[model samples]
Target: MEDNIRNSDRAPLPVGLYPHARKVGGLLFLSGVGPRKKDSKNIPGVELNDKGEIVSYDIETQCKSVFENVRMILEDCGSSWDKLVDVQVFLTNMKDDFSTFNKVYADYFKDIQPCRTTVEINALPTPIAIELKCVAEVSS
Candidate 1:
C-alpha cells in the first residue's frame, strides 16, 4: 500500500501543520506527541508563573500522558503499544527529569521493551516538557 497520513480526532492537535502519523508499507511513524489533551491549553503537569514561564512541572505526570497520547495515535492508526519498534523521547531537562521519566517509562515499557533513545532538547513547539516520536509495525 501507499504511504497514508493519519490523524486522530481524539488526540491533541499538532502544534504545526502535520498529521499524527504516517503509514508506509508495514510501518507506522508517529509525529512528536506531547502531553496536551485535545482542545485544552493547559499541559498535564505544567505550572506557569504569572509571567507565563514554567515554574515547576511533574515529569511523571507528563510521561504518562505522553505515553497515552502515543498509544492513542498508534491505535488510531491501526497499531498498538506492543507494536512499537522504536521510541525517541525528547525532554527539556535531562538532569532533573530523566530519573522520573525513566521510572514512568519503565512501567509502560517493561514488557514491550522497544529500542529507545532519550535526548535533551532546548524546547518543544509548545510548553510541554516531554514529547515522543515512535515507530510501530503495522500488522498485515
Candidate 2:
C-alpha cells in the first residue's frame, strides 16, 4: 500500500511567489529575503547618510534590518532562526563593513551556527547595505 499524506493547511505568503511551503521529504527550501514590507517599494528603516554637502552611507543599520528581514521570512515558512542551515550574505562594501556586519550577525545567530558565506558586490538597489539569503529545516 502506498502512503498518503496531505498538507493543505499551511498559510500562503502574499508575494507573487510560491505559496504553502514546499517540502521535499523532510527538507524545506525558502527564497531570498530583503527588507521590503508587504506594500512598500523601498525598504523601511534605510536612511541615506548625508555629509556636510553630500550624502554618504550607513552600513550598521542596514545590516541589522537585513537580519530582521531574514528572521521574518523564516517565521513565515514555519521555521525559526535556530533551524537555519545555511546563509548567504551580499554586500556592496565588504572590506569596509565586514567587521561591523559580523558584529550584528553574532547577535542573531549566537547559539545556532549555520554555514554562511559573504560576498562583495558593486551595488544594491538603492543604498541598501546588505541582502541575505538563507536555507532552513523544519522539524518533522
- Highest lDDT: give the candidate number: 1
| Alpha-carbon RMSD, candidate 1 | 1.5
Compared with the true structure, what per-residue lDDT tens digits does model 1 show for residues 25-80? Answer: 89999999999999988899999888878898998999999998999999988899
Residues 15-60, candidate 2: write the lDDT tens digits: 4534323444555555545555554544554544453221445667
Q: What overall lDDT, based on C-alpha atoms, would model 1 receive against the true structure?
A: 0.91
How far is each candidate from the true structure, as Cα RMSD in Å?
A: 1.5, 6.2
| Ten-residue stretch with the least lDDT total in model 2 | 1-10
TM-score, prediction 1: 0.95
The estimated TM-scores of all candidates read: 0.95, 0.71
| Collision pairs in model 2 | none
